[model samples]
Target: MRFEIMNAGKIQLCASLCMWLGIVTWTGNMKLHIWSVFVQQSYEGDVVFSVLNEQVNVSKGLRDGKTFSIRSPVTRKNAIEHRVFWSAWLDSLSTRVFGVEHERAWRKQVRDARVVVLEAGCGRPTNRLATFSDGTRACVRYGIDADQVLGETLSYYLAELLGISNLPPLALSKLNLSSEQWASVRGHIEALEWSPNAIVSLTEFIPNVTGVFIPLHLRKQQGGLQLSPETVSNMTVTYLVELMQWSDLIIFDYLTANFDRIVSHIFSLQWDARVMERTTNNLLKTINGHLLFIDNEAGIVHGYRVLDLWERYHRLLLGSSCIFRRSTVRRISEMKRSGDSAKLLCELYRAREPLARELGSLSQEHALTLQNRIDVVYKHIQQCTDIM
Candidate 1:
């Protein structure tokens, strides 16, 4: 599996090159503020939004921001754990795939998921949750987390919204099930004091969310040996070799959980695979069969968000972690000899002239960051190129 996945080659900062060539542009400075009514009254929260350019106070709980209503998604009091989790997942893939380019695209993917949706690894519905109108086709929100505590909160939240007490009853009719599958499902139903068939049937979940916020954190923890970062002084290579195997199962679960609806109307699912490093960047499924893979790690790293990584780096990296050495150059080079993706990534990284000219003309902070990025990525490209 690692060999097949590696065949796709290590994608380089070519996302940088692509950006320079007008395919995508890197963004380091972008305002992200949608202060919600819920965030205002919290004990630990402060409310501030630009009402006029005067930046007035908003204490009355104005609901003019982006939300379905004052009461749609489940509300949780303490929500930072999940927010950090989602950001971590995004950080890992963002730097590697679309380095220096996916700043906006990543959020856009989740925001634009207008059809079938799944918020995998949803700790709490804290950041940028989706919204749909009444006529919207089964815009069912499915959030799955491995943590029972989190799941308990999420299930309760959903039940309150759906007007029931226990686990969500299937909101559709005609569940698709083979004999064995049905028997297994029946057993689960009987054991739990819950009935997924009451409001809707199992069949209606088709084209629906299998597990909306399915948490792959469990898989990551179980697969710890494979995803561990091996360090040698400064060079850190997160050995994400074994995670490819679970990609299909993850998608299958997503599909099964949402199998309640067939999605006649346009249903968009923001498949946020924050965990499972290797597979998170993989193009697992597509909207109506259109393959979509969003790699925005580069943007995160260059944006100075690595402060988060740097803080927790010791926890994730082995002590043997050494400063990235010249020897590490061969690691990338060996790939370029046989891997197309590596070559593409390297070329993108090396396209300094176009990048500096295109992106250099932006704000001072952005220009400085892009220049710093080009220098680092180029060093890697140059070190590896001579090896092959």
Candidate 2:
């Protein structure tokens, strides 16, 4: 029995020691500066983000009536890469990736993307964003741009893309209240407390919104709007500030020919080994003691090592055992078409989401949420069971 247990620990240790700080090292030809060398092989437990308290707010100096702080855990400095001239290039790539019949293909893709987006735009080639986001099964999209969409044909495309009938509530229910959903919710929430979005690993999320989103200020430059990419990006920030409140993050097109706006953030994604090493060195000074090193970037959380010491401390202190937690995926299996009615599905989802929150949280409000979730789930179960 002891041998079996020890063997299990060794296996767990192996997974935790895998290469995580890595980009898809498919081949040297596709290599884009191999800087994400600190990859984690696997991570134990859910690499989570628990707010210490809702009352505690970091006063990171306010700018323009808004303040910023690193609300999630820091996984900075995995070797980053950039692709310049990406707008035009991405258009072709997306066309190939998503296929010409974008409606059918893209709709299906969104049901499985890391982030889903519903955008309204005509100027920017929409599918570039769509194709890139489609690689993951954790996304859905809806677009109302008259030109970009092909009418009810497009509406149907959106309906299918979101994986539901043409109903707002049904589609809305599919959203996991994560970052992508919060973008939509922020548009509605008046008070605008912390974005009620769930935690996410270091996966880069960039939503697709259309409208040329360029600057009217640069409409009639004497040089025929020959602006640098960086300037263009700066302009986009100003434009975004008007159109959407503030996204958790923004991703710019990797326009290679135009190198103006592809700044440090872009450079980070572009995979600079030197920069990555420097960033890793700095983190060692900060969080290395708490989090053990794990696979770097190939899977979920990007930078930061999986701190085993802290994991052991918490597991013992909290008396919770990690079961298949090191797999490093925040996945939701697609609802099987078991002839289950959409209404029931929505109800079931609504009932359990609060329970998920209650289970996932580890804050001071845990007790209050626990009671509320119990009440909500109990009532929901009772209703369905009584009907049955």
Point to the candidate with the largest TM-score. 1
Q: What does candidate 2's lDDT look like per residue over 1-388, in tens digits?
A: 0111122234422222121111111111111111111112124422222222222111211121122222231211111012111232111111111123442443343334443333332122221122234353221222222111111121222222223221111112132444453344444322322224322211112233121222242222133222233343333222322211101001100100111111232235346534323322101111111111111111111000122222232222111111111000011012122222233323443352332232231222322322332243234323423432
Candidate 2: residue 282 Cα off by (Å): 36
Error in Å for residue 307 of model 2: 58
lDDT of each: 0.24, 0.22
Off by over 4 Å in 2: 1-219, 223-388
Off by over 4 Å in 1: 1-124, 134-363
Which 10 consecutive residues of model 1 have the lowest summed lDDT? Answer: 1-10
Error of 2 at 323 (Å): 58
lDDT of 1 at 126: 20
CA lDDT for candidate 2: 0.22
Expressed as tens digits, the lDDT of each residue in 223-281 for candidate 1 is 32121221111111121111221222222112112111111000212253333333322
lDDT of 1: 0.24
